[model samples]
Target: ENIYLNGAILGMRKREINRKFDEIVDFSGCARYIDTPVKRYSSGMTVRLGFAVAAFLEPEILVVDEVLAVGDAEFQKKAIGKMQDVSRNEGRTVLFVSHNMAAVRKLCNKGILLENGQLFASGEVSDILSLYQTRSIEKIKSKKIIENEKLGNAEFRVLSIDAISPEGSVLSIESGVKIQLEFENNIENKNIAISIFIVTLEDLILFEAPIIFSSDNNSQKGKYLIEWDIQPFLLNSGTYKINLLVGESQKYIVYKKDDILTFEIENALFDQGLNLNRLPGVMRPKVDFKISSL
Candidate 1:
C-alpha cells in the first residue's frame, strides 16, 4: 500500500501503478512482507522497497546514492540491471553516486571524480577509474610488516617484501618488475615452500607464483632472500597488492599475509599502435602474433 501511495505521490497513475505493482514487488523480493507495515521493515528491506517504488514509478530522473550497498548481492545485481534498463531502453536519466569503482565502471559511461567537495576529474569511466585507483594506491603507506602475529608454530617469519623495477625506479607497464622477499627460517629438517599472489585492488587473485623447495640448502635454518622477476608487458596498468604464503609442500601453511605490499603499474609512455587505451583485462601479456596476407 505504501509503495502504491508513494507511486501516486510521485505522479504515477493508478492504472500505471497497478500495471507495475507485481514487478515492483518481485524485483524487491518483498512480496511476503507486502502487507507488513513499513515501520516493521529492516533497513535493507526498506531500502529495497524504496528503490523498487522509485524505480517502478518511471520518473524522468532517478537519483541513487549508495543505496545498493545496503541490499544483498542478488538484489544489488537486479537493481543495477533495472537501472540499466531504465537508462537504455526507457531513455531515462540515472544520477548514481557510489564509491564502488567496479560497479561504476560497469554502469556509467561518464565519470566524475570528486575530491574534498570539489570537481577533480570528469571524463571516460575507465580513465577516471584508473586515476582513482592510482590516487588510492598513492595514499596507502608502504609498511615493512603489516601484522606482528607469528603464524603456524613460528617456523617461518617474514622479514620484508619489496616491489621494485629493474632500474630501481618507479614502476611502469614496460618495466620488468622484481619482487624481493626476505624471511627467517626456524626449522632445518622440514622443507619450506613460498607462494606469492598478485591480487587486484578489487580483491581478485590474478595469478600466483609458487617457489617449491627441491634442495636441502633452501631448507636450512637461517635468513634467506628470494627474488621473483615479472617480465615486461605481463601485467596491465593498475594498482596491485601482494599476498604471501609460506608452507610445506601443500601439507600445511606456516605463514600467510595479505596486502604485504601494494604497488602501482603506470601505463607505458610508448605507443603500441592500435592498442592505445588501457586493455580491458587484468593482464596485458606480450604474445607473439604472426599476421599473414591470407
Candidate 2:
C-alpha cells in the first residue's frame, strides 16, 4: 500500500534533548530561539525550535504540517536540511505537507497530496508535485471559450467547459458549485491524461485534483466534452482561476496547459464562523482526525 498516511507510522524517534539534545540542537543554531515565547520568536525561529524538538524525539516517521511556512528563509533551509538528514542518514520516513513544490521537489523522495482532506495523489516527488502544480492552478481561473491552442508540441482546437447543478462550478464566486468542463481534445492517442488546477492572481495554486484520464475516447477527432462533476468546490474568499490541460503523465505533450479560466470568491458567501480563514495548507480536502484528551 502507498505509505505517508497520518496514522500509519507509530514509532517516533524522540530526542530527550532537555540537556544533551539541547547541546546538539544548539549546534544546529536553535539556541538563539529556544525558550522564547511562541509569539516572540520569528517565523524561522519557530521552525528551528520545532525541528530541534522533532529531531531530538527521533520519530520514525516525521510528519510536518503547514508549520514550515512559518519559518524564516534561512531556517526554512535549515529545517528542510534537518528533515532530509532524519530521513536519509537515520533511514526514518518523513511526511511533509507544503504548497511549496520547489521545496517538496528538493527535499522529499516521495510526495502525498491531500484534497479536501482526502488523499488524492501520492508517489515520487516529481510526478506528485507535477499533478499538484497542474490541478491546484485550475480551480481559480475563469472558464473560457477558445479555439486553436498549442501546448508543448501539440495543437488543440477547443470549445468550452460547462456547469451542471449539484456540480462544483469552476471559476465561480460560490462554493459547492458543481460544474463540467468540455473541450475539443484534439490529440493523437487513445490513452490521454487530463488534470485541472486553480490558481490565485499571484499564480499560486489553491489546490488541484488528481490526474483524470480517458481510457474510453473512441474517436480521436475534432470537438469533445470533458465533464467535470465537481460538487464541493471549497475555497476561501479569494480571486482564483481554472487551468486546463490534456497531456500524458510526466513526458506526454501538453495540448492545453495553464489556460487561465478565472473566478472571484466573495467573503459574504460563507456563513458566520464558516470563514475561519484557516484553510489547511493548500490542499483543502477533508482530513480524518481523532482526538484523545491528554
TM values, all candidates: 0.69, 0.42
Clashing pairs in 1: none
Where in model 2 is the C-alpha error above 4 Å? 1-19, 24-44, 142-294
lDDT of each: 0.84, 0.57
Q: How well does model 1 score by local distance difference test?
A: 0.84
Winning model by TM-score: 1
Q: What is the Å distance of residue 62 in model 1 from its true position?
A: 2.5
lDDT of 1 at 224: 84
Residue 188 in candidate 1, Cα distance off native in Å: 7.0
What lDDT tens digits, residue by residue, belong to model 2 across residues 164-257? 3352333333444443555555555556666677776446765666554554646465566665544344555444566666666557655655
Tell me how far the alpha carbon of residue 171 in candidate 2 is from the true structure, in angstroms, after superposition. Answer: 25
Model 2: how far residue 184 lies from native, Å? 31
